[model samples]
Target chain A: MQRYKIKISYDGTDYSGWQVQPDRVTIQQVIENAIKKITGQVVKIHGSGRTDNGVHAVAQIAHFDIETQMLPKALLRAVNCIINPDIRIISISKVSQAFHARKSAKSKEYRYFIWNGDQVTPFLYRYRTLIRQPLDVAAMKKAARQLIGRHDFSAFTANPNREVESTVRSLGMLKVTRRGQEITISASSNGFLYKMVRSLAGFLIRVGEGAVKPETATEVLNSQIRTARVPTAPAKGLFLWHVKY
Target chain B: MQRYKIKISYDGTDYSGWQVQPDRVTIQQVIENAIKKITGQVVKIHGSGRTDNGVHAVAQIAHFDIETQMLPKALLRAVNCIINPDIRIISISKVSQAFHARKSAKSKEYRYFIWNGDQVTPFLYRYRTLIRQPLDVAAMKKAARQLIGRHDFSAFTANPNREVESTVRSLGMLKVTRRGQEITISASSNGFLYKMVRSLAGFLIRVGEGAVKPETATEVLNSQIRTARVPTAPAKGLFLWHVKY
Candidate 1:
């Protein structure tokens, strides 16, 4: 069997999430169904990670093993043609047998978009989180700096479905920038816990609103307590930006 | 009666268009219904112009008269509170009785967005027209220059419901700019004919793709013929950017 890595992009608005469930529609299930029709085999593709409902993806990486001898270009075209319009298979390439989508990933970057405006533009209604309250971007930026290194991010994780071995993760980057009424929070890390990025977004927004102090990030990390964590930002605002090998 | 000039914005992806039609939903109908519910009176609201099906607007100007004693701010809040999320009443101000929504307009700026990319993102699925072909931006810009200034634009208008008295319209500006895979065509004119911008978009795209010569605009204007017009671009790409008085 040959392993093929595929880069995907999807609008996760109508999807339950990435993983397949008993009766719910999911990004993984949709693609798998398309693959099953094409190859006439049950193909289980492994995603780098699962995104929550309503979260979007610009470049999600996944891999699957197949015995078919089809070329990479033909496989990409065939899969994309059969899949839903909301999901796109951007590229596909043959990877080594040892390449695992989740385990081999060096880092993943997530972006959270906030429309810090009085009204949400209809065109941007599905993508951004509109906040009526004015944000202190400077405070948010300062809070981001406190999360730049390795820490036991247990406080930043949401309720996980399974028991996690460890919650320690290294942050490669984190920052906030504002353009017009749009505020974007970009975060990159070697690994992330389930809903970690969403939790971070909520915590930073509270800092921006002056509801929490700028040093709240450091306090939460040092304490390593989940009870002090802020509410998870809405799933619509989160996007899986990139998965780097 | 108090005349109110309101600036509106809407996502036209779901509605039929701006004007009311039998057995169809529209931006105007939704707003009018909101007004009717707020005031318990039948009122006629006049829009600056009609936008075709699936055409969006960021700053469309319109006027309506009401006998309510409520202030402009209260009226604005009440109307917006009831309208659907896809449509937004941006601002409302009291206008003189002489301000007619259609006749009092000076210039209208329309923007057409093209996602000239290999793949369309889910976030921008409803807004931009995706084109897979590589377009010549320089050629498109040159063709746009030929459409500027006063000329008989008979060939640009499509399927007008009424016979136009004169097809001559002064174009203030027309240009194309690209940001990454997104190409925007911004057109400002004293007025536009029915589906005029869409016609222009189709014409420019043909020129960009080398299907039509750059000098075709001049030839079409000189001919003063309606049958020589190119195909109308899709309605989803066109937006009423602004209505200036």
Candidate 2:
């Protein structure tokens, strides 16, 4: 058996997230179906993480083990041919059996896009969340700084499907930058709880909107309890940018 | 009657061409319907030019005369609210009665995008034309220079819907530039013949692929007849970038 690690990019507009479900079409199910058509083997592929529906990915990593004689390049082409054009297998290579797609990931980066304009541009409506009111970037940056270290981020996560051993996470970076009418919030962490990045984005946006003070971020972190103040930004603006191994 | 000039932007993937045809959904038809809903008047809007089906626009110009009490800003907001999200009224202003969208235009610029890569990025598939083979950007640039001048460009235009008095057009600029895996072909002219920009792009692509010599552009122009060698590029890659009046 050979394990193949693949780098993928997908526009998740038409997908029901990355996980496989009973009836809904998903990114995982589509890719797995394409692999089965190419290799004639039913295999379970593991993704780095599950992205919510309508959340895009620039470089999502995954791995699958199969008994096949085809080279990684040829398999990549064959799998891509069978899958929808919205999902592309960027590159594929053989890996050791021990290298799990999820467990082996060292750090992950996610970026949230906000169109801080009176009206969202027509071509950009799908990729960005529209914020009609002008945001205070300075306030957002100050608030983002408060969340940039190790802490129990319970206030920044949604309910998980399974029990987690711990909610403490080392957020390596949380940066907010704006160019023209687009604001980008980039977050990097060793690992994140369910919906944590979107929660962070939403909190920062509230700060930018003057609804919440910048210093309030520390109080929310110390509380470590989920509250309405930390809303989850829509999935469409969030992108799983990269997974570093 | 107030004559209003509007700058519009649209993602043309879901609509027919700019012109209205029976049983076909078009950009003009949608905007007209939106105007009727807003003002209760059936008014005809004149576009600077017609874009082929699937061709996008960044700043397409148009004008209409209507009797209404609403201010330009209010009318802009109301029309946008009624139209599909894919089409936007970027700006609207009252123009003089003698101003015309098409007749008064002095020059127009169009841009064509080509993804000269192994595969088109998933998020950009609708906006770019994918060419699997690597293109010679230097060669394409050399060929493009030959098209930048006043000339009788009979060989470059497609079949017109109506008879034209002359085919002579002042080609102000024809530039080819590449950034990473994407190539942009920009054309500016006093006026373009039907499908002229796409025809130019197609011919230059053939030259970049080494299928045609760079110097052959002059011969094709001098022939004063359309030939099978110059295929029209797909409308998906074309954009009505701007119209200068």
Candidate 3:
């Protein structure tokens, strides 16, 4: 068996997510099926992490093992040819047997887009969330600074699917930037809990709207409890930007 | 009856074109239908020009007359509510009755986008044309400069639907710009003939690929004849950018 690491990019609008479930069309299932057709073997691929439905990915890393003699370039072409155009295999490379897609040490970056305009542009309807009212970006930026560094991010995550030993994470960066009517919130962290990024975005949005004070971010983090105040932003606005291993 | 000038933006991937036709879904038909629903009267709207199928518009100007007392903002909202999200009326304001969408235009700007990359981004597949090979932007720019002046542009047009007394048009601006893997060709002219912008884009692309000399643009224009060398670029990459009155 030979191990291969692959980078993928996907438009997740019509997909269930990165994980497979019965009778649901998912990014993982689509790629796995394409690999099965090309290699004639049932092979399972492990993603760096799962993205929820309607969330896009610019560069998602994954690893798989297969017993095949085909070169990496040929295998990449064959799999891409069989999969839908919305999901693409960006690159594939041979990796050591000890490398794991999920367990590798590094960080991940996610971006949330908001169309802060009277009406979202027609071309961007599927990719961005619309916030008709103007947002206080300065307030959002001030609030973002408080969330950086190591902390227990329990308030930022929803119910966990698996047993988690700790909710603490080292946040490397949290930035808010605006270009014309588009506002982008970028977050980078060692590891994120379920819905953590969306929760952070939602909370900051409230702060920007003047509904919550900028200091509330620290209060929420120290309380170590998820509350209604930190609403989960819509999935369509989020993109899994990069995963560094 | 009151005349109103409106700015529109549409994702033209699904519609046939900007003009109304029998038994075809078009931008004109969609807008007219929405207006009829709001005003309870069949109305006719005139566009500055027609865009082919799969061509987008950032701010296509149009004008219409209706016998109603509804305010412009209310009418704008009503029409948008009835129309699909892919088509939007950016703004509507009362205009002089003498104003005509097509006849009163001073100049129009159109843009063509090319993704010069190994693989087209998944999210941009429907919005841009992909050219996998590297292109010489300098060569394309040199060729574009030759087209920026008043000339008989018969070679740039495919076929005229209506009889034209003269093919002469003032070419105000023709610029080529590249940002990362995307190349944009912006053309501004007093007016364009059928498929004129696309034809120019196609010719420039050939020059960029070193398949044609930079001086060929003048030769083709001076010939005043449409030939196979000036291919029509794909509609998906074309956008009606702006119209100046």
Which candidate's lDDT is highest? 2
lDDT of 2 by residue, A46-148 (tens): 9999999999999999999999878999998888878878999999999999999899999999999999987777788888999989999999999999999
- On residues A1-245, what C-alpha lDDT tens digit does candidate 3 reach at each position? 99999999999999998999999999999999999999998999999999999899999999999998779999988887777778888999999999999999499999999999877778888789888789999999999999999998888898643435988889999999999999999999879989999999999989988999998889988998888999999998999999987
Instruction: Decide which is better by lDDT, 1 or 3.
Output: 3
The DockQ values of the predictions, listed in order, are 0.56, 0.70, 0.58
List the candidate numbers ranked by lDDT, top first. 2, 3, 1
B-chain TM-score for every candidate? 0.95, 0.97, 0.97
User: Which stretch of 10 consecutive residues in model 2 chain A shows the poorest summed lDDT?
Assistant: A158-167
CA lDDT of each candidate? 0.88, 0.92, 0.91
Fnat for model 3? 0.61
In model 1, pairs of residues that clash are: none
Regions of candidate 2 where Cα sits further than 4 Å from its true position? A160-162, B160-162
Q: Give candidate 3's iRMS in Å, 1 decimal.
A: 1.5
What TM-score, over all chains together, does every model reach? 0.91, 0.96, 0.92
Considering DockQ, where higher is better, how would the candidates rank from best to worst?
Answer: 2, 3, 1
Off by over 4 Å in 3: A77-82, A160-164, B160-162
